[model samples]
Structure formats: structure tokens, C-alpha cells
Target: MAIAAASTSSFPHLNHTLFPKCPSLSHHYHFRPLRVPFTVRASSAVVLERDSITQPQVTSKVELFACPVCFEPLIRKGPPGFNLPAIYRSGFKCATCNKTYSSKNIYLDLTITAGTKDYTESQPARTELFRSPLVSFLYERGWRQNFNRSGFPGPDEEFNMAQEFFKPSEGGVLVDVSCGSGLFSRKFAKSGTYSKVVALDFSENMLRQCYDFIKNDDTILATNLALVRADVSRLPFASGSIDAVHAGAALHCWPSPSNAIAEINRILRSGGVFVGTTFLRVSSTTPEILRPFIRQRVSQSYSYFTQEEIEDLCSTCGLINYTSKVQQSFIMFTAQKP
Candidate 1:
């Protein structure tokens, strides 16, 4: 792969800080924009500078300003001040309204290149495949790609629940399992409510994405975010070693949620908190008709549990003082391990 020398401005070796000269054997990260037909690659940990054009370069910053639905910026209309190759300067599009962004904020990063085939998968034989497969859905939906998943009702509400649950709940410890990019976990990490913030995910790519978000000095020292890759049911830490456990949009992904829940109970200190969010079913409409179509588009999370079933599960596990609510299509729950 071609490499670039990140130089500061128009000077030669301006001697500015570069991303710590790469890290352990670097792995290429393949990323794809939603609704787009292409994938991009970032070679290893190479720092991308604005100068010293030594390698291929591109970025999603422009798309960030544009609408995903319409592929245009949400700002102002303009001929554009910056020049680009015909292919690179694709007009600005909005991610939500699909409108065009007509402002100066909509600039594109030219550091990214076409991604490799290694990170992609062959199309599933059947569209209903997502119903049974969890990881594949995550991999495709840009799990760690910063897609602003806050739009998902279930996941969004659960995040709100966790936000409130951990708030005012003084200093202790917290763990977020199957955390994708640790975005919601960042709430507690930023709240200063926990002594230790552990962000656990089964995918290293996910963890790398988390680091990408929390690598700044402020986060490292203030939140004390620790990245760990471990199964939800079988964590490497000792039993009862954790004080609080939180998960966002991860319940359905686990192969055996019961075991994971049980482990969560075991790991919490007598008053440690467990705040989590996961997808749940809202429309009881006939699954027969929508199931096949919906499942084909994306792995509809496991038929989300009803509020009653969730409460029952918590009760069966001996949880006390539980709080639950149904928002849109998600069931958000939190319980104390008394």
C-alpha cells in the first residue's frame, strides 16, 4: 500500500506531533459509507497530515457535512471554493434529509482510499440470514464506523436510561459490555461518576474505534477508560470484581443472553449498577409478512422482549428495585443486585 508523509503546512518536516509513529503491527481498517456503493481503507496507523502528499488520501468529513440520503450538504449552495478530481468532488448530500449542504463547512478529506476485500463478506444466500446472525449485521451497519446510530429508537432510549441511571449515582465503577465504539459509555466516562470505566467488546476493530474516540489525554486520565476484548458471558476479570455493568444495543447480539445476564449479576458488587439498552419488538403485527422482508434488509435484532418478559428475567435473577420503560421499539431496563 502507498504511504503519505504528513507534513505541517508548506514547510519541510515542520516537526509537529504525529500520531506516536504508529503502533503495534498495524491493521488496515475497511470502512463503507451507508447507502453508498463503495468502501474506503486507511492503511495501518499512519498519521494523515495536511502536507507532504506521499500517499493516496481521502476522508468522510465532507460526507459528514452532506446528507446521507440525498448526497448533498445541508448548508448553502455554492459552486465550491475547493477543487477536486471529478470523482472526488461528488456534490454534497445530507445524511438524513437527503438535501444538499450549501455551506463552507462541507469540505472533504482526501486521505482515504478504496478498501480491500479482506474485511468484506460475500452476500448471504438468503435475506432472512440477519435474523439468526448478529455479528454480520453489526459488521455491515458500520457498527464502529460512527454512523450516528442514535437514530435507532431502542438503542437511543436505552442510552438515555443509562445516562439517567448513572447520573447522581456517586462514584463507584462501571463496565460497558459489547460496547460499540464506546459512544454511550462515554457519557458515564465523562460524568466522573465511576472510578474506572471499562469498555469491553468482542471485536478488536470495535475497540480500535473506541480508542479513536477516547485517545485524547482528557479522556484517558479523567474517565480512565479501559478497553477489553472478552465474551460477555465469560469475562477475564474475577467474579464480583465489577461494581456496575452497562450495555448498549448488545443484548440480541449475544449468543446466550441468559448466561451474560447471570455473569453480570455475579460480577456486580452488592450495590453496583447495571444499566443497559437493547432492541425490543414494538409492533406485534404479523411477523410472517414483514419478517422475511425486514430480516433481508438488516438483521432485525432478535424479536425484542416485551416489557413483562424483561421484568420477569430480572426478577428471576433476584434483581431488586428495577425500573423499566418502553420507548418506541426498545425496552430500557436497569436493576440493582441487592
Candidate 2:
């Protein structure tokens, strides 16, 4: 839940405290459920790793853990006791802000549970919680601005990779699949590269976010855009209708990615483009070591794509021009339907 702006000065101290509490670090659970109150609004918010399957919000067993806001570390001791394993619950002294809340005391629930169908279904709930309040609050407070402001860092790199493999404008209809808040979609719309930028996603909240951002920006509005609410697995478009398809940080959440590719191929025109970027697999064989990042997302979960897998999927989808690269912890794969 902490952003990059949060200080990490106390990281060393925090690590010291954590190791002492759990001496058998390897055996200790990598993550425990915590209800993080992200906004000033008093509501339980979920906080988890960005790469694991276990979510913190949906679980019944919530524990207690407090991370210092200033240093973004769990306070080991505070106030009168600099060395005590304690938290300054009341308030904290800040050099710049007179006495401020240096810590946010929250829960770290560790309830026992089984991974059944019911347990797995909890993923959607976690995704919703993140998309609704977490992402919304981040957007409203300008957290997302930092993500895109510095010139859409990831997209340019991705597009550059695609360009190396194919011409910049094999232009026709482009579909920005799983376009969160429409940053990539707007980028394409503003690029003046395609005739239509079909901004699509399963989450209405996310699609709406993209819709609002695009409609307000004259550059994006200038280019034709159509928002479609449809799951990727069962795309509503006719076969071979789309010219290019690109999805940024959003393949893992599809539930059935292979089927989604089938649909993507179904809609993309012959000799069209299909581009994707995903996280490298975080180790599916060992869940215990990395099972607590929480929530299914394009960055985590089924998010990462292996090179062989990418080529295989492209080959299966009838895409001929297969090109891929690993950049900034992402597998950028570009293929063309021929």
C-alpha cells in the first residue's frame, strides 16, 4: 500500500525488528493478511504483495501490524523507548510537521484456511476492493499521476520493441485490451497511429476511469474511440475485424488467458498485430515462498509470460511475425496475424 514517495530510511531497522520476531525467517509465512486503511475514510483496506496468490483483504483471519508512515517501516520501538519492541500508538514527533502520525497501526490477521473453490473465488472480491477504493483513492490523490506523468515509461519501451519488429503504422483498428484508466489507450489515440482505439476491459470501474480520462483529454477525443464492456475470453467482436491488439499489464486476470488469445485472434484481421507485456513468472512451483502478494493482476498472477510460451501461443493463434523481449521485469511479446 505504501508508494515510492514514502521514506525508506528506517528499512534497515524494520528488517532488524522483523528478523528477531520470526527467527525462522524461511519457515515463517511470507505474508499475513492486513486491513490497511488507505484513505482518511475509516474502512478496512487490504494490503498485500503484488506477486502472490494469497490476498489479505478477503481472508477471515486478520492479524495486527503497523508500518511507520514516514519511513514506511514497521516500528520496532517508539517515543520513550527507542529499543523496545513497541509502536508509538498515540502520535509521533516529526521534525518538519510538529507531532504527526508516524505510524498507521493496522491488522495482520493469520487465520487458517483451506484452498478450495470458495477460497479461490475470493480473488475476484480482492480485485474489486483494489479497483474500487484502492485504485480510486490513488487516482483521486494523484498517486497514479506519478505512474504516468514521467512520459508513460513502460509504453514507450514496449512500443519501441514492437516497432523494431514491425512498422509503426500497419494501421487499421487497434484494441487496447485491459487498458487500465486508458493511459495506453490515450497514448495510442494521441499517437494518431490507428483509426479506432477500442479501449476494453472487464472492470467497469477501470473502464470508466479510462473513459473519463480519455473524454476529458481533447487529444484522445480527437481520435475516434469506442468503449466496449466485454470479457476477453468471449470477445463480442466479429472474427478478423481488428487490426492490432495490445494489452498492458493485464493478462493474468483473464482467468483463461489461452481462451482469451483465441478470442483475440478471432477478432484481429489477417496480418494484424498483437502485442503484450507481462511480469516474468514468479515461481508457480513453490507457492509457500511467494503466496502472499495478494490479488490477481496484470502485473502479478498469471501475468508473467515465458518466451517459449509466448511463441507457442502466438503460433497457435496463427500469428506469424513473432518477436519478444524482456524489459524492466516484463516480457514484451509482439506477434502478427498472417
Q: Per-candidate TM vs. native?
A: 0.51, 0.52
Model 1 C-alpha lDDT per residue in residues 35-75, reported as the tens digit of each score: 22212222432111222253333332221122223323232
On the 0 to 100 scale, the lDDT of residue 337 in model 1 is: 81
lDDT of 2 by residue, 145-224 (tens): 45343223455665666544435435566777877666677777677677666676655567556645644455555465
Q: Give the whole-model CA lDDT for all candidates, comma-separated.
A: 0.47, 0.49
* Runs off by more than 4 Å, candidate 1: 1-160, 167-169, 283-303
How well does candidate 1 score on lDDT at residue 82? 23
Q: After superposition, how far is residue 246 of candidate 2 from its true place, in Å?
A: 0.6
Residue pairs in collision within model 2: 49-293, 62-109, 63-107, 63-108, 63-109, 64-108, 271-337, 279-304
* lDDT at 252, model 2: 52
